[model samples]
Target: MLTREWATLPEFAAMALPGVPETRALQKWAISGNWSRPEWRNVYWRRRSGTCGAIEYSYQLLDRPAQLAWMQRHVVISVEDEIAAFGDDKRYADEWRMFHEASQTKQKKALEILQHLDRLHRLMEAGHTLEIAIYDVCREFGLKRTTVMNWRRRVKYVCRHHWLPFLLPGNKGATGPRAACDEQAWEFYRSDYLRAERPNHSDCYRRMVAAAEKNGWVVPSAKTMQRRINELPTAVIKMAREGRDRVKDMVPAQERDRTHLHALQAVNADGHKWDVFVKWPDGTVARPMMVAWQDLYSNMFLSWRVDRSENTDAIQLALGDLVEKWGIPQRAYLDNGRAFASKRMTGGAKTRFRFKVREGDAAGVMTILGIETIFVTPYSGQSKPIERGFRDFAQGLSKHPAFAGAYTGNNPMAKPENYGSSAVPLETFLAVISDGIKEHNSRLGRNTAVCGGVKSFRQVFEESLAQVQPRKPVAQQRHLWLRAAENLTTNKKDGSFKFLGNRYFGSFLNDHLGESIVVRFDPQDLHQDMHVYSMDGRYLGDAPIIEKTGFDTTAAAAEKKRAEKLLTKATKMRLDAEKALSPAELVALMPDLDEDGEDLVESKVVQQFRPRAVVAGSSALALDCDEEQELAREREEMAEVMQLRDYL
Candidate 1:
């Protein structure tokens, strides 16, 4: 092909034209330079000489097809020869050998090399020699020629071995100067430094030095020791320095997935001591205890009670308030505290207080109400969602201006500026808590993390209540669920019942005297009326308070003395009710009795009518009626019998 027509040919279409030398000396130098072009290898008609003369080309003598064929064959041969003769330098040769050896073990590194092989291979396919290809790759990737060469060797090794190079494992950042210290020194450092109450860095360093010198080991500098301690895993540091209970503060709180729970489906109850000082009814300053039940799904405070102490009675009062307002909960999550886990709250178990119990001896409130009880792990506050609500409660309500000067800190180290300057009354404290809880429930943003959308606590709760039917206690049957009950016998004479040194009386109980019956009353309201129930759980009428014998300043002196005297009498009556029937007493109640207080002998006729059987062994005897004797007695009493139908 002609030089002018070379541009039209596919082979030379993408290449820049080669320039001619300006002088004969330059041309001669270029011809003798032995500079073979990778693209020129396809031009077989070109010729060169070792003289200061222009080279001649004769490719025009051949047709286009013949020229194209020569270009293809020679280009392929040149590329093959270049790759075969590459890596002749000693450094390149060593790298190539090492690359092959590493292919079996350094699979990860080899794979990384393969990632960049595409760009390098594309340049070589475009008629560039191996050296030019490596240089172009280095420029394209902004990598050094040596790095490019190493990568090329790795690629070739991977192609040959059909595998990649392995990667080095990651190392921990704690493998520094501290590792030089002995295990004994580490133990001393951990005990003295990484404890529930951690010591200061300088103190820990000084102690560590002393321990190291005694143990014949090198000690770490204060700065290095501090860094080492800081470098420890956050979880490890929290658990070691603050104990497992406080480790939750260091970790991110887990958002509970509560889509399955509905409002009133599950409620969590826990007691918290108000950090602020409050005055009790009897004029004493102390932190009042607050027990509250919160809905798990909506985070709404259902009910709460303020008391001087935490006990099962307080818990029941709070729970009962919720039942009265929102209906019964399906499940209750409680802490593993003594008050929450008491028999009165959780029911008696086969094992409690480290003792075996008989079946049916104890019945818990949850069991009676058919509510499931879920006790969180001991000391794990985060497990109960109410704890988070309580934190907000303390900061919002307990810190109100009304409680100014009375605000105490949540912990001993965080006392307020006006700590102990004043105190709030119990009633005022409760009022603040109640109002704060109402605001919290109605406030927006409680459902920010909820899936449906953002809403207030009350909105979510009301929506949930709309979807499912909640169990509500019947008004007439409230007595069964409102109080803890026990079975007691009524006084046979006046049908009076005594509990907690108080007497309860009912006219309907007269028929139930000497019989076991269930009595229900609130322990907190001993002076109030109580509901009476039959042994079979049938509700009787309410029993009114007959007298406030436990503690009553209104009673006169004579009345007080009489009330105290009834204690022994009530005990005697209770014991007598439990006494078993004697054989003589049973014989006295038989037929043919005399009105006078005297025992009569058995008549012959009466003996014939009454059939008797004697026992061979003991003093016991069995009684039966003889059919023949009974018929003879009826025949003799026929004349004395009157017709009841005619008299009517």
Candidate 2:
């Protein structure tokens, strides 16, 4: 398309004047009209190749109609049309590879041969004999006639078109010996060398040689075995030597799209134990586990709790804080850890595998609040987004200036020189963590999908929050996550139970005394009331802590008095209601047995009894005087033996 810079006399004549088909007639007309003048804006001339004389004219010198004709004749409408017009073939795939690998001189020679072939094809297309075409190409390219024929013969059988690759000089296949080792020897070497134990190549070669000597097989050299190992695919070698998990890790991980999620719509939770040492309130030094919940959409750290270790209580409280402050999330991506899978958090989930699933189990906080719980793969950090945030925290928070001596490296082997030299107080550690978390959320230009590398996480979260209505749990619903659940039985005597060293009692518990019920309470605040539920998940009532006092204290006396008053009031109410119906009135209220005027039903079977006779007698006692004296002496000996037995 208007690509040619210049056109010859015959080309210009055929394009500019369709009527003047003869080049000699067009030249005569141009001379008679004197069209070569500079003011005419036509017939601009350019020197011919390898000649001082002008032979071509610029296409711009033609009139509008002639230029249009030329453009229409040569215009390329599409890129594919242009490529197809060049007759480019796919065979160049191999040709270019061989050409690149060949020596510089060989590469130059291959290009020269390709140019000669182009000319030879053109000459042959013009009705010249093959020999004559080859001779002309050889004469023009300064090559021998035999050399040109030999290049053509080299590609004659295999490649009919795009035969530049086959025409390349030098060995086209692999070099060196073909059969270095037999199948049996190769198999033995592979088995010995490509093991999970990963033996060295030289050692494996020596072992293979020893085995070859005994088996009468030919073995290859150590270098040859090493080369073969290198030729094996990396994945295959890794699978054989490094194990399946290592090979699996080499594969790219799946990416998740969270563009549709909004703030508080979904969140992820995980526990990370900080490497920095802190002195706990109990006077013990240890690394603290921070259970954190992050908003999935904005990647913002919504809430967190620090404890001596990861536990159900810490996770529950952290989730509670998240719900209380930012509203309830629709879904939670959690770690497959015992704390995250606790019955208190995910009790009734069908996918929960940590505890035994049972019928009529109390629903967990997530189940009660209608939030979906998704457990990530166990021990897989990539499955949870919070792990990345925790990594960032580890880099900044753990290495803070306030924790200089207390900074313990991520692993034992990476510990700093001053590790264990000192420990920060728990209060100071918490304060620093609070400041760090604030700064992390408020930092500008968060390079996340939601932030678009322009806004902070807090800004992104708040913007989304403004556009969506997140579920907000009321005070009663908040207890579902804020409190831990336990199946406990109330005391049979007073309908009260001991929990966390405190006695909890409720008047409603009197009806459920000695019966198993679900009790949910805040572990951090034992003084607050606990929410009670039946085993079948029905809310019973709240049980307040029964505060203790000295027996002689006025408070104790007042409490006793209050209890007595309550009992008296309850008994009076019951008695008054009962008295409303007198004994006779109650009897009258009962149904009369003879109202139908039917005879009483009798027993069908008879019970038999045996008769007994009784004899009554009052006989007078009489004894002789001699007999009486002997009886008196026997009685005295009996009395002495009784006295000795009593003394012993």
Best by TM-score: 2
Residues 273-359, candidate 2: write the lDDT tens digits: 998999999999999999999998998999999999999888888988988888889989887788899888888887787877887
Candidate 1: segments with Cα more than 4 A from true spot: 1-255, 348-362, 448-453, 480-497, 502-518, 522-527, 532-648
RMSD of each: 16.5, 12.9
What residue pairs clash in candidate 1, if any at all?
105-166, 106-165, 106-166, 107-164, 107-165, 107-166, 108-165, 347-364
TM-scores, all models, native as reference: 0.54, 0.66
User: Where does candidate 2 clash, by residue pair?
Assistant: none
Question: What would the per-residue lDDT of candidate 1 be over residues 1-648, giving only the tens digit for each residue?
Answer: 012322222233223223322345433543565433445543632433553443343323233333333333332222123235453434234334334444344535444454345445644554567777676556545678886665554344333222122111121111122336566766677678777777788888788887777879776567766766665667788887778866767668776787778889899988888888999899999999999999888888899888888877778878888888889899888777788877656664322342234343445556556678877776677789888888887777878989999999889899977789999998898888888889988887554554245688888889888998889877655665477677577898768888777788876786787776667787768777888877545677889887533333434545645855685687678778887677788787878756797977876664336666855765333333576678888986774455422322
Q: Using lDDT as the measure, which candidate wins?
A: 2
lDDT scores of the candidates, listed in order: 0.65, 0.78
Deviation in angstroms for 254 in model 1? 5.5
